[model samples]
Each structure stands twice: as structure tokens, then as C-alpha cells.
Target: MRRWRGRFLARLRAIAPRYPPRREVDRQARADMAASSVEGGLPGRRRANPSMLPRRIPLYRELIRATFQPE
Candidate 1:
């Protein structure tokens, strides 16, 4: 058991430096998303459908159209 544990830990330590920590990976992903968004890259997630707005809210529909379909 002791030998196995030692081998496992030694292998882990040797491999650890090859990968960034989870938090660092997440931070980098967020930064990349922000940069892409600023550059008008494709959205990472689906956007809401403007057609889903109630007919009573013409202003909302117009705003959505104006924002997404710029003349």
C-alpha cells in the first residue's frame, strides 16, 4: 500500500506541471470569450427569439429588430 501510494503521488507530481490548474483554465476561457465577443465573433450561446415578445410590446420588438438587424 505504501509503495503504491508513493508511486501514485510521484506520478501525479510529475504530471501536474503539464496542465494548468482548473481555475486558471476557466479564467482563460472567460477571457477568450470576452475577446471574441468584442470582435463580433459568434455568440457562445443561443440568443432569445425576438418573435417571442408579446404583440402588445411593439417597442420591444422594434428594439430587438433595430439592434439585431441594423440598417
Candidate 2:
């Protein structure tokens, strides 16, 4: 679920910057991604915290676009 959302978001971000400045949004997105990559407790049971998804969607969309649609 999380991964899927990330991919989706990366695509969106890749398209065109909407809210705020791209620089600020990009920086914040990267930080959010980092926060969601931690190994939670329990075996075969990873959990994504509330704040972990601040940039998963948009960031994912942007990532997809960037890798595939280069200028």
C-alpha cells in the first residue's frame, strides 16, 4: 500500500509543481520519505507512521516522472 502510494505520488510531483515553491516542496518531500523508511518492530510486520506519508504519494509520482521522462 505504501509503496504503491509512493509510486503514484512520484508521478504527480514529476509533472509540475503546484503548491508553494518546488525547492521547498522537494526538500520536505525527501525528508518525509526518509522518515517512512524505518524498520518497525515485530517480524514480517512493518508499519508506516502517520507522518511517514507526508511525501509518499507526490514524491512517488515525481520520482516516476523524473526517471522515465527526462528532458
Candidate 3:
């Protein structure tokens, strides 16, 4: 009985290759599709430092600070 059960389980396992679970497959598919140019997507983002400004715009910071100060 043990031999037969083992053989049955083995045959069942052999019949199928181990595929990633459905959620992982869906996530990879989404990532791949998004990576393609046709999908019009970017991988990540960048943010500029708050204090970083062009030398030409030195007065812009002072102007903004004065404009928005609480009355």
C-alpha cells in the first residue's frame, strides 16, 4: 500500500513541472510588459534637492520666502 501510494504521488508530481505560483507569474508579466517601450513606462523616479537651484535663480528663493510668509 505504501509503495503504491508513493508511486501515485510521484507520478502526479512528475506530470507537472514546478511553475511559480500564479501571483508571481502575474507580477513578472506586469514588470516585463511595463518595461517594454510600447507600454510607455519608466522604471523609477528622481527628486531634486530642495536647496539645489541654478546660480541664475538665486533671487527666486528669497522672493518665494518673502511671498509666502504668514501675515
Candidate 4:
């Protein structure tokens, strides 16, 4: 089972794309596709340094509370 699983995975990896598309006449299309897919995705919040951001005080408090709460 293990040997067959390893061979199957190796074959799958070999079939995957090996490089980014080379830029050419299709560069605009590729760029637009990439931008639409990536930028249209959800907005993400970056974590500011806790000491620099007062908002993180309550976040840390909640996290600590959840960690110690009985499960």
C-alpha cells in the first residue's frame, strides 16, 4: 500500500505545471485573470504589533480567555 501510494503521488506531481506562463501577447489576458481572481477575493486584516495597536488588547484578552477555558 505504501509503495503504490508513493508511486501514485510521484506521477501526479510530474503532471503538474512546472513554471509560470511566459509573458508574451497573452500577457494582458494572464494579468487580468490573475488580478481579477486575487483582488476579487476577501479582504484580509494584517496584525499590527500588539504594543503599537490598542485594538489588540481586547483580542489578546479574548484569546487568553479561550485558551484557559475548560473544554
**How accurate locally, in lDDT, is each candidate?**
0.38, 0.46, 0.34, 0.37
lDDT of 2 by residue, 1-71 (tens): 36644664565465545443323345445434543443222212435445544435566557544544535
Q: What is the RMSD of candidate 2?
A: 9.8
Q: Name the runs in model 3 displaced over 4 angstroms.
A: 18-71
> Model 3 clash pairs?
none
lDDT of 4 by residue, 3-71 (tens): 434553453344334422222223334234333333333222233333333443355345333433345
Instruction: In model 1, state the lDDT of residue 64.
Output: 31
Worst 10 residues of 1 by lDDT: 37-46
Clash pairs, model 4 backbone:
none
Among all windows of 10 consecutive residues in model 3, the one with the lowest summed lDDT is 37-46
TM-score for each model: 0.29, 0.27, 0.24, 0.25
Off by over 4 Å in 4: 1-25, 43-71
lDDT at 56, model 1? 25
Of 1 and 2, the candidate ahead on TM-score is 1
Top TM-score: which candidate number? Answer: 1
Global local distance difference test of model 3? 0.34
The true-versus-predicted C-alpha distance at residue 48 of model 1, in Å, is 56
Candidates sorted on TM-score, descending: 1, 2, 4, 3
